[model samples]
Target: YKETLSGPTRLISIDGADHTFGSIPWQEELFSNTLEFILANLS
Candidate 1:
């Protein structure tokens, strides 16, 4: 499912993350990545 992006796509992986991020320890990393992505695309 990570092979269909058109452009400007990023695929981040949290070692122990699951589909729902349940009990995951990388939630902060997830949010940070998301925010960085958004900020970088802002014009």
Candidate 2:
């Protein structure tokens, strides 16, 4: 995960969040950022 990104990439570390992101308050942010990234890259 750390070696692949050499150029354009976004790495967001959510504090107090785990891999599942279950029952977490910042889950909304995770979804929001994912949507934003997808929308931004769409052609």
What candidate 1 gets wrong by more than 4 Å, as runs, is 1-24
Off by over 4 Å in 2: 1-23
lDDT at residue 18 of model 2 (Cα atoms): 44
Write model 2 residue lDDT over 1-43, tens digit each, in one string.
4332222342344333345455655755755676577678875
lDDT of 1: 0.50
Clashes of 2: 0
Give lDDT per model, in order. Answer: 0.50, 0.50
Candidate 2 global CA lDDT score: 0.50
Worst 10 residues of 2 by lDDT: 2-11
